[model samples]
Target chain A: MALTGLFLCTFLLVHLIGNLQLFKADGGMAFNVYAVFMTTNPLIKFTSYGLYAIIIFHAFWGLYLVSENKKARPVAYAMVDGKANSQWTSRWMGVLGTIILAFIVMHMAGFWAKYKFGEVPYVQYERNIVDGSMTYGPSAPIESKKEQFVSAETGMEYTIVKDLYTEVAVAFKEWWIVLLYVLAMAAVSFHLVHGFSSAFQTLGVHHSKYNGLIKFVGIWVFGIIVPILFAAMPVYFFIQ
Target chain B: MKITLKVWRQKNTNTSGQFETYKLDHVSEDMSFLEMFDVLNEQLINEGKEPVVFDHDCREGICGMCSMYINGRPHGPKHGVTTCQLHMRSFKDGDIIVVEPWRAAAFPVLKDLSVDRSSFDRIMSAGGFVSVNAGNAQDANNLPIGKEIADEAFMSAACIGCGACVAACKNASAMLFVSAKVSQLALLPQGQPEAKRRAIAMVNQMDAEGFGACTNTGACSAECPKEISLSNIARLNREYLSASFTAQVD
Candidate 1:
């Protein structure tokens, strides 16, 4: 569970980096190009399969651990001040994880699945000319060649490209969607607060000298900083 | 002082338990928690009723036989003290004190507040002792253990085999108890020979005993009568991982 959780943590950072491209002021050209690159890159595509497997395994393993824990105490105490014994997040990791799992399902369905299979509307950026040959559009120049161009795949003169950036922007423009993203990111933060250093301890990397430092980073950096940055993305787009 | 007691009462291992409340007046402030229970038991005995049954060996806090969860804490609200050592001064007049047995599947209540703690003994017996042969006491200087290492080991060794760590755990995990024993042995030169075997054996026993995995909550240490550090749990993790990797050669 620890190894898989850490793997997911790394993936979060990479995903955050990719998503940050949406904030660029290039009329969605750069962001869409990056999104296409992420989807098409063979290496990333293969790793994405592994990522999916890890996420599912992490969730199930967590479920198994929690079920076994529940069995450890068959009789419930009449009065329990659980806060006296442990942190709220430590006790409710399963609940937070389930929330994140639900969020992941909705998130992928809303964005990833739509980008892949849903009918995403398209925009036509002006094609550029460099060195006497037609090249991809540039951010600064907004001119398209007047000559009619035919596409083999659709068999039509392509007037537009897939406008995934606008899809994201439109989604964020709704206050409810942004609210959901913020709430889900809050769950992610709580999950990481326990999971970050917990994975190291589970994998037996707890050094006498470095253990405290690891926990510090787990609670402070991963728990606080990463979640804030992630939540900020939607808020940034909503205002924009 | 006047106080209200909500103590768990169970007939036997086969019967379900419930709380029975008893109000007491003129309670002394200096009376230990156990003494207050004794007063209650005296009242029950005077009324020709079966008194509450609980476990206690060395009331001064050394022998970890005492098991009770008072007011949502393993050993009442006091830190670094057993239930027997806790004084009534910690409570106020007209206080409501709720006490129960250690709640764990592995620790079924035999009767009243007494639960079976043989699960701890089983885990301990799996590998808690060194294999040194019987002989006259060796010279104290022979070990040559550094002061820091000796202090660390002694701290871990202070674990009195109490079930408070287990009771205090949300998952009913025995990690603190098991880890304290492991950490004590893992730190000493006498315990080095069988270190790998001991780690694996004890941890496997802990798992088989239906204890939950440690999620590093630090509650055990907080409520520990001995105040055993959570670092011991970390050391146990390290030791177990090391043993699993090198067990083939051993």
Candidate 2:
């Protein structure tokens, strides 16, 4: 469970970085281009599919272990007292995971679904096949194609291809939506802060000579990367 | 000086509990916290009120029985000390002290400030014993253990099973208790016979007891009266991993 969880944590950093591209200055085009690349790339497609499997397995197994632990003691203690010794975040991983899961669903629906099947209005531009002269305007209805080249602003109309940076920027610029992304990232960060080192410990990687270094690295990876990647999204969109 | 005591009173395991307040007057700063509790009990007895029930075997701190959460801190704000070892001078004259029992799902409160820590006993029973048969005491020279391993095992064995580690832990994890038992046995040659079973059974029992998982917070060791090391938990993890791997065939 911890191994899978740690893997998920690693995936979060990459996922957050990919999502952060949405907030780039070129509107949503850069993000959409990145997203399109991510979706169409065979390697990313394989890894992401594996990532989905890991998330489901980790979540269900974690819930199973929690329930099994709960069943060990059927009765509640009369005096509910230990608040001094445990970390607040460690104590509430389940709640945090649940919240993050909800946000993940929302995030997928908002962006992943939109990029995949949702119709996005695009501007059309006429281009001379052999020459550089062209007129930019609203293009005809050209259905989304898989791995096919398309102009960022003018969509499929421009034979001269462009990236989807503008679409990504536009998607992330919304204040309320960016706020939710930030929150989800925070949850992911907090979850990773404890989960990363814990996985190593559980996997018996605790050698006295190098355990400290390993834990330190784990802290840096989880404590720093997830939040910064997600936070960069809003900062990039709003500031730019 | 008068101190307000908010004590957790539970009629029984089935019934819910609440904090009941009592006032203690003219408390001596020189008295230990348990001594102060004794004085209050004396007053309660004289006034025909039921005296507060709490667990305490050795007031000298070696027994590990004086487990109490005083003012939100286990063992009452003193580091490396049990509740019995805590001095009244640690508090101001008019301070209100909140006393409660260990609140983990495993350690159910039996009465006012008294919890059933037999979960520790059950966990220990799962694998905490050596398999030595009845016989004459062996000579100290029979088996010579390295001084360092002996010292480490003694430190781990110093844990009194007082449940203070759990009370001090924010997650109510009993890793300190479980690890101490595992370490104590794992350190000696005599413990080798059942080492793997001991680790597996005790950890399984610990999980079965509904205690929260250890997240390596180190709070349990910090608040331990005996100051048991967190490294023991790491050792236990090693033991558990080895045991689980070997047990795959068994």
Candidate 3:
């Protein structure tokens, strides 16, 4: 669970960084192009499969651990105060994990599935070579899903691809969708606050010399920065 | 002080238990928690009733014999003290105190408020000791240890084998206890010869005992009477991992 959890944490950073393209001023061109690259690149495509498996495995293994823990103490304490010693996030990892799992499914259904198999509108971006000015609109009817062309007449480069950016925009247009993503990111924040450092401890990596660094990266980087940045994408689109 | 006590009453390990509440009046605020229990037992005996069963040897904290889940905490609400060391002054008049035995499959209740912590004994036997050559008092002076190392080892050794950590853990994990033993021995040169094997053997026994795995919740340390540090658990993990990966032991 620790190794797999760290793997997922690394993936979160990569995913968050890649998705930061959404914040670019380009009309989703960079994000859509980046999305296409992510799905089509053989190495990343292969890694995505492993990522999916790891996510599922992490969730199930976590639940199994929970069951084993429960079995260890079959009879619950009649009047125990759980809050006395432990942090709430540390104790509710399973519940928070379950929420993140559900959120993953919902998130994939909304964007990933749509980009892969659903009806995503296509767009064409035309950029002038001289001025670096760009124009994008619905692609002229074409059989190819994605194509890049340089115009001979006006020295313009045109790139046409599936408008996953539009798909993102359309999805985030709904207040509920934005709310769900924000809430899921909050769950992600809570999950990592305990999970990041806990993983290191389980991996036998705890030491006083490095404990502070581990905790700082765990809480500030994974728990705060990563989730906030990922969350900002959807909210940015919603409010835009 | 007048206090209501809700004590768990169980006939045996195979039998189920229920909460039996008894009202104790004129309880002295100066009395220890166990002494308060003694008062309740005396009252029960006078009324021609069976006295409550509990585990206690030395009336001091060093015995580690007394085990109770008082008001949801392993050793009552006070920190850094066993139930025997807990005073009734920590509570107020008309307070309801709930007391029960350690709840873990590994530590089954022998009767009301007394659990069989023999599993801990088994774990101790597994790898908690070092095989040292029998020698005279010169043995103590022969091996020298750094003060810092000795202090750390002593901190780990302070674990009294009171099953409070297990009782306090949500997972009933014995990580703190096992790690404390492992950490203490591994810190000393005398224990270095078998440290690898000891780590593996003790961890195997811990797993065999059906204690839950550590989730790093910090409850075990927080509720520990001796305040055993969680760093010992980290060292246990490191030692166990090193053993499993590199140890030559079978």
Top model by lDDT, which number? 3
Per-residue lDDT over B7-124 for candidate 3, one digit per residue giving the tens place of the 0 to 100 score: 9999999999999999999899899999999999999999999999999999889989999999889999999999999999999999999998999989999999999999999999
**lDDT of model 2, residue B190:** 80
Candidate order, TM-score descending: 3, 1, 2
By DockQ, the candidates rank as 3, 1, 2
Off by over 4 Å in 3: A140-145, B134-144
lDDT of 1 by residue, A45-135 (tens): 9999999999999998999989989999899998886787678887788999999999999999999999888877656554332222223
Which candidate number has the best TM-score?
3
Instruction: Give me candidate 1's TM-score against the actual structure.
Output: 0.92
lDDT of 1 by residue, B1-250 (tens): 9999999999998899899999999799999898988998999999999999999888999999888899999999989999999999999999999999999988989999999999999998999988887367679997698999989999999999879999988899999999899989889888999899999999999999888878777788889999998878878988998898889663
Question: Model 2: per-residue lDDT, tens digit, A1-240?
Answer: 767977886777687677776644433444545665788899999998998888778877777766655543344443333455545666567767887888878877876777677765554345444454556433445545422344556433342123344454666778887888788778877776777777777665666788787777666777776577677766576666
Model 2 chain A is weakest, by summed lDDT over 10 consecutive residues, at A155-164
Per-residue lDDT tens digits of candidate 2, residues B1-250? 7889888887887798787888988899999999999998999999998898988987999987887887767787888999888988899989988887777788887887888889999998899999776377689888899999999999999999998877766557788899899999899988988899999999999888878776566678878889998788878988998998886445
Candidate 1 clashing pairs, residues 3+ apart or interchain:
A123-A161
Query: What is the docking quality class of candidate 2?
Result: incorrect
Instruction: Point out the higher-scoring one by TM-score: 2 or 3.
Output: 3
Sequence-dependent TM-score of model 3 = 0.97
Off by over 4 Å in 1: A127-161
List candidate 2 stretches off by more than 4 Å: A16-34, A41-43, A60-87, A121-164, B133-148, B215-217, B248-250
